[model samples]
Target: AFTVDVKSVANKQIPCHPEQKMLDAFLRRGEWIPNSCNQGTCGTCKVKVLSGTVAHPPTPDSVLSYQEQEEGFVLTCQSVPTSDVVIAVPAADKPSSTGHLLRDMTATVLQMQTTATDTLTISVGIDEPLEFSAGQYVELAIPGTNDVRQYSMANPPSQSNVLEFHIRRQPGGLATDAWIFDSLTAGDAINLTGPWGDFVYDDDDDETGMILLAGGTGLAPLKSIALHALTVNPQREIHLYHGVRRSADLYDVEFWESLARNYSGVRYVPCVSREHWSGRTGYVGDAMLADFDSCRNYSGYLCGPPAMVDAGVKAFKRKRMSARRIRREKYTPAP
Candidate 1:
């Protein structure tokens, strides 16, 4: 047991212990941390380890580089303090009421469609309707594998009865490889958890244009928010950049194109990193930077692999975008 002294962005001090995970300890004491992937990949749970000796579990090198490890930065989800410590975390402006509403949900698979070789668009209907904002994710329990995984919903709150998820079958992922590829069928029941995440769009800020950045299945939550935005306010200008390695990997291309065609204010840009055929080559962030000259005035929302999200954030920062104007959900694979 060690003393963990947590400091908020405003420098407020909160006392905690090392016995519990940092996030659980903070939440138990009426504090909160922004998070999505509880794994070390999403940089969302990153905090400045002002002073402490923390023991980190062995993680993939791709998650955090040596430079980041050299700095006092640490992912709260993957670090355990060895002694008394002080750390700084982002301030919680409006702590979620949904935090108290966290509970387990048992849902039945309503439908499933293979959109790509390893990607599936699954729709699960909960036994009890859930009230969740866009950009939130639910943990699903794989029946036979006994492995639970988190996936973001691609359907918005307006689509109440159905929760849509874009699931990619990871090569060796225990849960996905087993359930998604082999066992999962329509009508199969799976357990789920609370709609977790704080990266949802600020619906009150209607004047701020939205810049959505997505990679691979990271398009899930962003699609939800985009659909919601179109449904509630069709006049809002939205620039969506979806990136993939190949053109074939670009799932739901026609859907997004149709949305853009239907909504005059919505602009959809597809970016491919490969050099094979001709469309748009290079990084997705570069594509956005090349096309949009007024990124500084736009509010950015990013959901994707940590690399893409980090790159997009850095690009926006270079364009004079403030930290307050960006919301991100880092999708890190579990190691």
Candidate 2:
């Protein structure tokens, strides 16, 4: 057995079995670690190895570049401690705010529909009530692969028994592809653990207008936030920009348009990147820039691929937006 000196903003020592992944070990001990895409592709699980040795399985080069690895950064999801290890994690923004609460849920698949070629709109209903703020996600573990995939909850907290997921079927995604295209059916029972993620709606900041950016399936969490905002404050003057490759790729466009029509304050803009697109044709970031000349006073929430999130953050910074005002969650493809 190995010992771990886990130091985050909390500064605590946690021990783990030598064979356990750092994240699993932390969760087992009731410690929270911010993570998505447990397959080591998303950088959300990044941590600094302050000391001691670790044995990390080979990870995709896209996950951590040469410079990051040289700097002693490792994906805790893929790293196993060989000896006592010391790690440093970024402090939680809200210390008192606990990360997503954990609970075992046996949900029955209520509805499943394909939104795009690879995206699915899956609705599941739990036997008991569950509460989670907008922009939180849950983990669905598949039996055979022992792989846990995280999908953001698309429904609002007010919808206690229903859980919605906008899942994109990765080419060989063990859990999602099987559930969406091939195997899962209505009435099927699936295990879920969640409401994970620190990205939540800020009800306190009512005066600050929100700029939401979504790319592909990243729209899941943003949808939840939009739904919640509509439910509470319908006149918030929020701007939502969703990016897709083709016009057909614009899943749930009618729903968004309906929201925009119903709520006079909400504006929905869809951007298409590929050809054969007559409507706003450009990258989502570019569309955002064209629509809003200045982001000086706005609060921005972005969720999507790492590339899109990274570019959006830089663009916002260039437009005089403060880092504190911009919140983002980057989704990394599973390796």
Candidate 3:
């Protein structure tokens, strides 16, 4: 066993087994560490090793670079300490509420709005009340099959028993194909488990600006974050960038525009990649750089395909945004 010291305002000492990952140790102690994809793919659990040696397998190049590895950066989800260690974890240092526990619940589809040709906005009424943060997700079990898919909630916490999601129809996707095209309809019942994930608003620092980046159906969670932020911190600077392929693919433009008008600090910028339009045209990464002078003072929340998230992270880093300040929730396919 080793003693792990997390250097923060109220420092904590955790007992860790040689074979256990640091995140597991902290979680066992009821200490929260912002993490997603415990398998080490997301890079959300990264912390600087102030004084320690840890052993870990090679991380994905997209998540951790050679330069980061050389700088004593370790993914807490993947690394096991070799000795008593001291590390700096920003999320651990910040004040956070007690975490939510996973729950099993049944829900009935309330409504389905066709947001775009390929995207559907779904609202479901939960059988039991659920309390979840804006950027969290749930594992949805598709009826008549063993397939289960994950989707982030698009509604605010105020809607306790009702949940909303933005789902995109995929050509061969098992769950999406059924939900969007064939079987799903209002009054259909589905089993789900969660209120999972930690991609939430950081009440820890209201002064820091918030930047939300979304792509395709990835806009679901970001929309929740933006709306919640508006209600909670009206004065906080929020920049939202939604990237899609074409003008027809864009949805909820009026909502964002109206939001910006009401909230002086909120700025909504939509980027289109494929076709030229009167609005911003290009990659979302390029649009972000073009829209803002610097990301050095902002806290970034990214949710999208891995490629889009990777590009945004690189751009944010180049603009001097610290890894600790950038929080990400990836929307990948369910296994």
Candidate 4:
């Protein structure tokens, strides 16, 4: 076991096994570290190593640069402490003495529909309503199995007992194959917990316009945030960029189109790649870059696969967007 000294939280010390991830150790000790994808793709759990070496798994090049690695910046979610170390975590990531409350509730599947060829939308009704912030996710455990998968809520909190999720089916996936594809059905009971996530909308930031970027089913959380934003502040300037590989994958286009047509404060830009579509092509980031010369006045929210989120970050940075004004969540395959 290796000792990890966290410099930001009153110099707390935690024990970490070489085989365990540093983030897991922090979490086990109820220490909060900003993280999204536990697989190390999001770059949210990054911390500065003050005086130690860490052994890490193979991280995507886009998540951490070589220079960052050399400078002792490590991704806690993917790295294991090789020796006793001192690390400095950002103040924003410090957990409260009382951590966020987590609840486990029983939900009965209300309906399941295919929104797109590869995307499934499932609505569940919980016996007791779950109070959660916008842009949070819940874990659904497969009945009669140890398998559990996390999916963000597509519906806003106003929906109360009714929660919705958009899931992109992965062929032969453990959860998909056993439950999501065939075994699960309407009225079936499923175990759920959460409302967990840091990618949340800040209602206090009324003056700063929001730029929401989403890819594929990553639209789930962004949709929740957008709707909540509209409800909270209808006059707020919010732009949504939804990207998909093909035109066929553009689910919820009609809803967004209606919003764009009727709401002056809301704008929807959908982009398609890997196909010739009359709409914007190439990448969603290209559309975002073309829409604004500078992002200094805007707050950014990004949720998607690592590649898409990373590209969006680079594009926003080129437009002089402050890193502090941007929040992100990256999606990766369930571990």
**What TM-score, computed on C-alpha atoms, does each candidate reach?**
0.77, 0.80, 0.75, 0.77
Candidate 2 all-Cα RMSD: 3.7
| Cα RMSD to the true fold for all candidates | 5.1, 3.7, 6.1, 5.0
lDDT of 3 at 58: 88
Q: Model 2 residue 290 lDDT? A: 78
Pick by lDDT: which candidate is best?
Answer: 4
Q: Given candidate 3, what's the lDDT at residue 90?
A: 57
> Residue 228, candidate 3: how far off, in angstroms?
1.5
User: Model 2: how far is 249 from its true place, Å?
Assistant: 1.5
lDDT of 4 by residue, 1-335 (tens): 99999987786999999887787777656567776666566687899999977988776669988888778889997889989999998656332122334567899999999888778889999977877778888888877786679899989888879999998888778887656986778988889867556777766566789999999999999999888888888887989999999999989988889987777889999999889989898788888999899999898899998899999999999999988778788888663
Q: Runs in model 4 with CA error above 4 Å?
A: 1-33, 38-90, 93-100
Q: After TM-score superposition, what is the CA distance of residue 285 in candidate 4 from its true location, in Å?
A: 0.4
Q: How much lDDT does each candidate structure score?
A: 0.78, 0.81, 0.82, 0.83
Q: Considering lDDT, where higher is better, how would the candidates rank from best to worst?
A: 4, 3, 2, 1
> In model 1, which runs have C-alpha deviations exceeding 4 angstroms?
1-33, 40-90, 95-100
The Cα RMSD of model 4 versus the native structure comes to 5.0
In model 2, the worst 10-residue window by lDDT is 92-101
Best-to-worst order by TM-score is: 2, 1, 4, 3
